[model samples]
Target: MAIEYLGLSQINGPLVVLEGVQNAAFDEIVEMTVNGNEHRLGRVIEIYNNKAIIQVYEGTEGMALRNTHTRLTGHPMEIGVSESMLGRTFNGIGIPIDGLGDIDADKMLDVNGKPLNPVTREYPRNYIRTGLSAIDGLTTLIRGQKLPIFSGNGLPHDQLAAQIVQQASLGDDTDEKFAIVFAAMGVKYDVADFFRRTFEESGVSDHVAMFINLANDPVVERLITPKVALTLAEYLAFERGMHILVILTDMTSFAEAMREVSSSKGEIPSRKGFPGYLYSELATIYERAGIVKGSKGSVTQIPILTMPNDDITHPIPDLTGYITEGQIVLDRLLQGQSVYPPINVLPSLSRLMKDGIGKGFTREDHQDVANQLFSCYAKVGDARALASVIGEDELSPIDKKYLEFGQAFEHQFVGQDLQENRTILETLNIGWKLLGMLPRKELDRIDTKILDQYYQPADRD
Candidate 1:
């Protein structure tokens, strides 16, 4: 039996408030009947005493106070998932929109299911290659690790996300089926279409599942998009035993949606007008990724969020850095130079990079080479700053060499074709070749034996 209410006390934005409600649980699904026959869906978000606040998923556009009927389903909202979800497209709420019929569901899962126990989580050790030298050679992404990309508006984060979906693979080529669950929150139509075409053109659509919430869709739906995408990823990873990659693009939109709902509900605001519980709310989504103990499959997350005004300390990126393992930062300065990925190595870091590379994983010199590059690049920055004050001709010989090394590093190493996929060996060799531009003493960060083996100087004509 269900509890039905004749009229709502208030309809504010996407929320409908009903008074004197009894036994109504939070997150319980509600069916609202409007104009005698039309149906709208919502979920109870908050309850105080006898008043229940429901967030309408389909928008409360035509909702009427006197005639509408609110019936509680007595359960939290769930998504029907099945193995057939691969190669399909769904709306933000998980309804099939590819003109495909409903999935013959294997099970139904609460979108807000509990996260994996900390005790059952295995340390993420293996590397996931995105094929871009900027990420692979420098800020490496580790399997089962949550690494977020911090980009700004008008940047190419979407292109980078799409490229990763097209190119990311396991260290071992024979690993199990690698699948992508991509969720686009409040993006434009062209942006969503671009991802679809890129997947199809790369022949990787068969390995991808997409959930889209466009800019004009109900704002409340944006809040559900990533959760729905992650739910599908959990099904594919743990149940079907497949390696899964979940990419949520523009999480800023998701956060904005939360802010909007909070404001509508008259909740107090915290930093930059976002709700106070924003950090924990984001964790509910980002923390869902990882390898469970004894499971053959793992879930890796690459959450891409645009920093407002390119501000890294903004609430969205600031809180994200605390929760995620590391961040891949995109620079507008490099974008102005026409860089494809525009990943600024100075601020970008992967804390788990050391764990994922070296010995049998990538290469023995991987860590040292990475260290030397950062050291040299830091010097290059100093040399450029000095040259700006005094002309390049007035600089010391070593300083000039650092200048030359900087350009070579960016053009030859950081700047790579968007479609080009380099093997780990090829990427490392390119790093060594760039390092050879400078004299042997500049390679102090690298071990002596390893440098002797890989760092021979390029013959200057």
Candidate 2:
């Protein structure tokens, strides 16, 4: 016989305390009825001495302590899993919202997926081309790696994400391409609509799925959005052997939502009023990306988070940096100069790209070109600083060249048109062309043989 309890204990925001509950387990799904017939879903978060506190996913908007009836369902939260989920749009909690009927679920999967075995993971290799020079040439995104984009407020992080979705996958066939699983949490309604409109209008591959939780939706659903999205990615990648690319945007929203739930639980807050377990909670999501030792398919991740007040030391991006492989930072200065992606190449890098992009992968001189670009760009700042003290006309000939190279690097290399899709070879060629504007001796970063081959002096004299 199932146990049903009459609730009159307490209610706090999204949480409700039900007294005298027997045989209740943590994370056990609960069914709550309001005004006799209308039902809502909840799950037990904390259990103490037969008393359970449940988080209502639909929010406790209509229910009261006295009128609500609660029943504990034995199992934890689960979502139906199947390959049919592709090319569909879903609400935060795995329910289809694209007007496409119910999924033909092959099986049900627990939203909190199993922990990945460290020994089973394969170090990521091979590059995933984004068709953008700033990334494809400088901070190459390697397959099966977890690379994050650290953006600030008002930056085009959302537009950048859509561009990535339109270009991230490779190969022309269904089996050869990568499947995209995108999760948007605590985003504005217009932002969600922009994603949908872009994906459909761009004819983004049928191997794409999105889970969205809007600003007005219940905060509890924001927490569940990423978990359910990853559950589906894991199913497709590890089990069904399909290459998966997971994009999680505005992770700051997720962290904030956690703070709200934690505060409601009366838990002690850590740094910046976030829970102490924030790091562990974030790891559970990021570490889910990678390839197992024997699996042909890999799960690569690009998690985007906007820093509060553009502070890099903020707990959200700071903790994320410790867990992720590397980050792509968007610079406000570059944005002011009218760069589309606004990627500050000096600080942004991919840790595993060195192993992925050389010889057989991208090009023979890929590493050399990237190194020279970084070295020259770094010197541009020094030349500009000296110019500020003594006028630009007073600087040495070499310093003047540095200023010119910087201008070309930003306007020509980093910035590209929205419809422009440059191949790896094309990006490398542009790098060499920019390097040519400087004197041959200034190109000390490149090897003597490489300079002899690719460096052609311009009519700067």
Best by TM-score: 1
Model 1 agreement with the true structure over 289-397: per-residue lDDT tens digits: 8999878888899999999998999999999999999999998988898877888899999998999999889999999999999999999999999999999999999
Tell me the deviation in Å of residue 329 in model 1. 0.5
Task: Kindly report which residue pairs in candidate 2 clash with one another.
Answer: none
Each prediction's number of clashing residue pairs: 0, 0
What is the Cα-based lDDT of residue 423 in candidate 2?
86
Model 2's number of clashes is: 0
Give residue 217's lDDT in candidate 1 (0 to 100): 93
Q: After superposition, how far is residue 203 of candidate 1 from its true place, in Å?
A: 1.0
Model 1 TM-score on a 0 to 1 scale: 0.97
TM per model? 0.97, 0.97
Error of 1 at 346 (Å): 0.8
